[model samples]
Target: MLEQKHYDVVILGGGPAGTSAAITLARTGASVALCERSRYQENRVGEMLSPWIRPLLTQLGQWEQFRQAGHLSCPGMVCCWGNSQPYENEFIFNPYGSGWQIDRNSFDRSLALAATEAGANVFFHTLVVDVNYEERFWKILVRKDGELRSFKANFLINALGRSQFPHTKEKIYLDSLVGVAQFFQNVSDFAIDDRRTLIEATEVGWWYSAQLPRGKAIAVLMTDRDLLPVKPKDLEAYWKKSLLTTIYTIARVNFWHSANKLHIYDARTSYQDSFSGQQWLSVGDAAATYDPLSAQGIIKAISNGINAAHAIASSEFSHAVSFNDYNEALLSSFATYTTERHLYYDRERRWEHTSFWQRRQGNHKFLYA
Candidate 1:
């Protein structure tokens, strides 16, 4: 048994939000520790960063590091929204300039490494089994490198991409969006179009295809949970049928053939009833999740990371208040995102009667459940 450890703050989950908060607070002289369970052994899908994220990276003092990492430049996005002809939203229109199509595994690892370099103790391959709040501090039990360890902190940050607090409850689930993807080898040879990302709205749902740095490309279908083709053969057949609904994807999937298997993941939107308590705060997706169509997940997570640190510093350092301001602001943002999501979804009138579309149109709701 290792001896107990102590820090001013402890963060769970070493992805962008946790690492970003650690970098901000540790540099300000706070003792910070972050626990991360894996080194990204699975395939991740959120690989595109919009141009608006460039300034946020600069604020994190990571712009130069991100530039030197050699990620592919994202030209912009092309969408088949209300009509069949694709509309282009180029990066040139963004004030912060070019976006990125990243290899998420390398990008996330870089952020974690940067946090350690900023003086935060980082525990890779560690899982925090349970957290107990007692007498103005949190007692965290973790399994680290095949050993159990104990740690204590005055403030805890949940960046685990899901709520881990008893005080907070999910007020509502806006929709049950699902993202199913397939990767094909050697796709660059067949794709002669501009390297920009392609998104098309179909009868059943929407589809996304992006060119990667290697000779590969990833294509995903976004629909509701109820629409997922569960059976092995059915999923394959449905994916092909959905792809064929769009002109941009018909040729792309046909080029690869139906050889690779599909991977399905949650892309739902929901907000916690509360975002912060006196001793703990939830940042990023743990606080609120957005639709994948927004392309704002990465930016929101990094920005929230910085905001969480600021909220902590302002209150406890001044001995004035708790985290109510943080909670209010997060809730406000969630409301605005919900409104915007509905507007974009309303644009696709072709499949209004379908279950996937009906869910987004706000026709069905177990509101406040």
Candidate 2:
């Protein structure tokens, strides 16, 4: 029989949320284990880290290190949101200087590695296939290095992105949100302003495009499924055709040569009905997934992990109410954000007659796959 290993906390998924939680717990002299199933990140979409992320990094004691990673700065967004004419929302207006546009792989790896640097035991290529309560602890069966290993922990944290955990029910705030994206490399250089992130909304949907480091650009369209082309065989042509419909993208992107396979991403806004139960809790997308418009994924995950750790470390009286408070607070905050989303979409009256805009007029809360 294999000997069972134990830690005070076991964090599943080595992404920002789990790793952040692991780092926070380990800092308090708690034995924490982080099990990451994959050593690699899959195809990821463009990520625009908000200017507010500066303080979040500072709060986590990773400002210097994150800055050293050398991601490209996105000073502002050139938006053609509700009108024909484009406008700019500069991050310079904020107290923080600029935001970041990252190659998603590098961003995630930095945080996970940071957790290891903070003295948390991080196991890569490890999958927790089975989880159960045994002897008042979380009994986890993980497959690592082509072998099985058993782990026990007083607390278990799920940060496995979305739909991976069955213990908690997820409530979808906006169900019909998804994206189709294409990557362009060796893109021609335009004016310096062309380097800024670009957003333009059409009658059927909206488009987001940004120039990354190394002359690469990521352009994507977000819309309801019904708004997409019905034939998969026509998807390639449809993608290029639709991208050309954008006010800014048509002139900026070369559809003739830049045509490539479209990558579909699930962009639903949602949250688990319950964030914590017994000795287990969830952080990041496992707890809640936000609208891409909010751009709060990284910051919210870090904040959730930090708050979860502090809550667990508080007095008995405080600890008793911690998770509930956390859940309630996030719920309230998301509700407000969804309301704002409704208002934002409402501004585009030209598309009000379309199903896309008409649907958004309703409170769109539905199940996401």
Q: Which of the numbered candidates is closest to the native, going by highest lDDT?
A: 1
- Model 2 Cα lDDT, one tens digit per residue, 93-126: 8888888887777777777788888888999999
- lDDT for each residue of candidate 1 in 1-369, tens digit (9 for 90 to 100): 567799889999887888888888888889999999987766667758998778888888889889888677888988998888889989897787778887777778888888899899999999888888887888899998888989998888988885455446643577778888887766655553656788899878899888665566789998887777666678888887777678987666666533357888888887776787767888988888898898888888998899998887666544235887788788777777877888898888878898777767754322332
**What is residue 320's positional error in candidate 2, in angstroms?**
6.5
Clashing pairs in 2: none
For candidate 1, the per-residue lDDT at 354 reads: 84
- The C-alpha RMSD in Å for every predicted model, in order, reads 2.4, 3.0
Per-prediction tally of clashes: 0, 0
Q: How much lDDT does candidate 1 score?
A: 0.81
List runs of model 2 lying over 4 Å from the truth. Answer: 170-173, 188-193, 255-260, 315-322, 362-369
Strongest candidate by TM-score: 1
Candidate 2 displacement at residue 350 in angstroms = 1.3
Candidate 1 colliding pairs = none
Residue 224 of model 2 has an lDDT of 79
lDDT of each: 0.81, 0.77
Positional deviation of residue 24's Cα in model 1 after best superposition, in angstroms:
0.5
